[model samples]
Target: MIGFSILNTINTDNDDLSGLNEIPFTVSYVTSIHRAQGLEYKNVKLVITDDDKTNMTHDIFYTAITRAKENLEIFWNAETQKFVIDNFEEQTQKWNKEIALINAIKNNK
Candidate 1:
């Protein structure tokens, strides 16, 4: 489990109630990339196991990398590393092309 503390301020029209507060929470150490979408964290650790290679996609990898706001660590075996290197550029270009097509369609509508 990972623990987090966040400071928040409380405000009210009443003169006696405005103050700073601390909120604490705990979260699991591991979560799926899909489940983590639209959330950002101070640090992220991504592990790609041999079993993951078969189902891994560029979008999933991209999402995991982007989730880290300040630091990111990635762990994978040599085979997974090679898989990323071999497909990275091609996949990026393909996604870019798809994005352009989507934008063109939206502009025409």
Candidate 2:
């Protein structure tokens, strides 16, 4: 596996190349959802494996889907499909309850 690391340089001059000691190399196209946070891409391809689903959360799934600016594709098995459905339903119910409470408060005022 190829790993990439970030280098911090204190020099402000663009002509100072002495700070760079290592040769430039390419990085993998794949990245974790956590690492991709606050970043947008023209296209995104997401793959969900059984191991991934074990640690998957609603927020992570949402973040993955929203990463794509123009197009997004997802690949998963039936088990993962069921898990996504259940998670969506749970989130929907939670939002509905919150909205109801807000409406009730407004009526009581």
Candidate 3:
């Protein structure tokens, strides 16, 4: 028994991958966050390449972090270290505010 796969990199001019079906055995998998919704894993390692603050929102960060059931790890390149740090600091402030609000509500109750 043997298996093979075709790694087709989509380009601006070529988008047709249907022709690959004639090759008998070819497979590809998508690990995108949108597609990973509803799936849970014991451990997850997420590596974010995009450091743009506009693209990396709190919701997106939360979604990616919450995917792991037990342990989750994150890695960023040196080029984006400052950006990552800034975002994390901002998010930490929001998290602390939320925690304080919850504590206030609990104390009132």
Measured with C-alpha atoms, the lDDT of residue 11 in candidate 1 is 48
The residue-by-residue lDDT of candidate 3 on 59-107, one tens digit each, is: 6667777888999888777766568668778988999999999999999
lDDT of 2 at 86: 85
Best by TM-score: 2
| Model 1 quality (TM-score) | 0.56
Kindly indicate the candidate among 1 and 2 with the higher lDDT: 2
Residue 28 displacement (Å), model 3: 12
Best by lDDT: 2
Task: Write down the worst ten-residue block by lDDT for model 1.
Answer: 1-10
Q: What 10-residue stretch in candidate 2 is worst by lDDT?
A: 1-10
Question: For each candidate, what TM-score against the reference?
Answer: 0.56, 0.57, 0.44
Which of candidates 1 and 3 reaches a greater lDDT? 1
Q: What is the C-alpha lDDT of each candidate?
A: 0.81, 0.83, 0.70
Per-prediction RMSD in angstroms?
A: 15.0, 11.9, 9.0
Give the per-residue lDDT digits (tens) of candidate 1, residues 1-109.
Answer: 4445433445445555335445556664778899999999898999988888766778788899999999999999999988876677777888899999999999999
lDDT of 1: 0.81
